[model samples]
Target: MYTPRTPRIVAARRLQRRKDRDQSGRFLAEGPQAVREALAAGVVLELFGTGSALDRYPELVAQAPEVSPVTDDALNALAETVHPQGLVAVCEQVDVPIGKALVKQPRLVAVVAEIRDPGNAGTVLRTADAAGADAVIFAGDAVDPYNGKCVRASAGSLFHVDVVRSPLTIIDLLQDSGLQVLATSGAGEDDVDSLLDGGLLDRPTAWLFGSEAHGLPEAMLAAADRRVRVPIYGAAESLNLAAAAAVCLYASARAQR
Candidate 1:
């Protein structure tokens, strides 16, 4: 195998400009697992650059058509982490379609609003893929679904699931589509397993999750046909966003089967 040449410059400076990602429609996805996931999901890789670990990933690289070599400093600039992985990829946006098809699907769906954290947003989408949810929608000022950390956190589910950035309210979308909406309120009034493994999966469902601090927007929950909570046996006040999503989506899938 031929050795790769490194890029000329190593950019230590963090380019915090707003339009950089928007302009390129690309973001930094770090780590081999993240890279493998993206490749498996069929994301259009604009560029793939690696560091010292390239030799360990001979098989993964063999699968890749070709890749550019990058300096650690250049990767550090774009990385969400301090100690960067040896590999980072620039990927094009995966635009998921919306409208009636979203509402018509038989699988349970997840919706997020004001989830500013890219990692959490990615987790929800990743959950959607695992639990076979029909789709995911980001309502209001949620994080960009295409953010690199989001994509990486998704573990490449960004390739399999339909993720929509919607201007319309989840309630309006639900109402128009004749879906039963469930909002996770953490109130512990009802159980999710009984709901899903029995009847909720029979009907088209849309699940809503909101900001970590604010929870679901009042209007969105008010429109919900049901507000459910994950039962707690422990003293923890809440669940991590990704964990909560995995539980919810899988419950719906188990119910349907």
Candidate 2:
């Protein structure tokens, strides 16, 4: 079993940091599901697991290229969660430039801006995937999608959709792609249902979501082709970012279908 100080183990631990991940263009995918998806994507450079984990997923271990057996202490040290499923995979980062993703002329996209929470970030990715969005862009101070918390929250959906991290305003990209960029806000003048009923959802579109603590920025809202609010039927004060995204994306999905 590999010790905690093993070169491979040390390198994988370093990937837990954003600086190292950025420099190396690699991140750690923890748990069986994320590792399984990473393996299927053929992006896994190395795999690590305990004896028990290997025994459970023998087929996956057989397919993985660089497998390393680790002691329990090493595995625990590698995992970010209190209860890791005893598996982690080192994977190449899988993000493309926003321009490159836009050039494909996607039918639907989700743009998350200035979101700080990794759990929320990952949930949005999962929702976007479920709605069959062609891409998801994390822009403007958003948390890294490759963060351990985010990866776990996304389950395996992070592997299903194109993810882009960009500093330039996504409004410009959406406009260039001929997509209707819809900014979500509580005080929006347009209602989501009305827009959906008016054939707006049939068009190629991009949904803009902001941080939970703060809604969309004024400039972003202004830049959008239209600003729309999801209707609140009950006494709830406001929808969180993930809930709002699910409603908006599913509406677009249903309408397009």
Candidate 3:
């Protein structure tokens, strides 16, 4: 069994960092679900699992291209979780070019702009996938989608959707996509339900979600076809990013279908 000191094990540990992952064009997917999805997506290059884990997931092991039996210490070194799940897989980065992601003329899309929290970003990705969004764009200093926390929070949805990391060309690309851009903000003129009632959500649309602390950039909000706010029914001050995104995405999903 491979130990923590093994050369390959040591190398796999570096994938925990974004810099190394970007340089190598690979990231670590931990737990059975993430690994299984990565395998199904044909992105898993190598899988590392403890003896018990391998036995527990024979079907997944059978599908992996390369499997390494590892000690608990080795698995722990590659995993980000406090309680390691005994499995981790090195998978290829799944992001595509912004132009390519928008080429299909998607009716519904989610643009995650400058969201610092990986968990929130991943949850948005999962929500998008659940709502049947065509693609998710990480634009303008957004959290890396390959972040371990983000990967885990995605719950295997990362491999199911077209993801794009576009630092600069998002606005230009969105304009070219022929989809109306809508920015979610607190001080928007239109409420989400109002948009739905007005039949605006039926159009091909891309929703722009910004940082949790600051909301969307002024430029993005200005460029959007409309600024939308999710109405607050309860006494809560505001909805968190993931919750707000779910509300907006599902609204579009309900309208479009």
Q: Pick the candidate with the highest lDDT.
A: 3
lDDT for each residue of candidate 1 in 127-204, tens digit (9 for 90 to 100): 888888877888888888776667777887777777777864658767567678888887735678778656765677
Higher-lDDT candidate of 2 and 3:
3
Where does candidate 3 have its weakest 10-residue lDDT segment?
167-176
Q: How close is candidate 1 to the true structure, as a TM-score?
A: 0.81
- Expressed as tens digits, the lDDT of each residue in 1-257 for candidate 3 is 99999999999899888899989999999999999899999999999999999999999999999999999888988899999889999999999987787788889999999999999999999999999998999988989999999999999999989999887346756877788888999999999999999998988889999988999989888888899999999899899999999999999999999
TM-score of each: 0.81, 0.98, 0.98
Least accurate 10 contiguous residues by lDDT in model 2: 167-176
Which parts of model 1 have CA positions greater than 4 angstroms off? 1-18, 63-66, 100-106, 188-190
Better of 1 and 3 by lDDT: 3
Position 235, candidate 1: lDDT: 93
> Which regions of candidate 2 fall more than 4 Å away from where they truly are?
none
Model 3: how far is 123 from its true place, Å?
Answer: 0.4
Candidate with the larger lDDT of 1 and 2:
2
lDDT of 2 by residue, 35-83 (tens): 9898988899989999999999998899899899999989998999988
Give the per-residue Cα lDDT of candidate 3 at 113.
Answer: 93
Q: Would you list the C-alpha lDDT of every candidate in the order shown?
A: 0.70, 0.91, 0.92
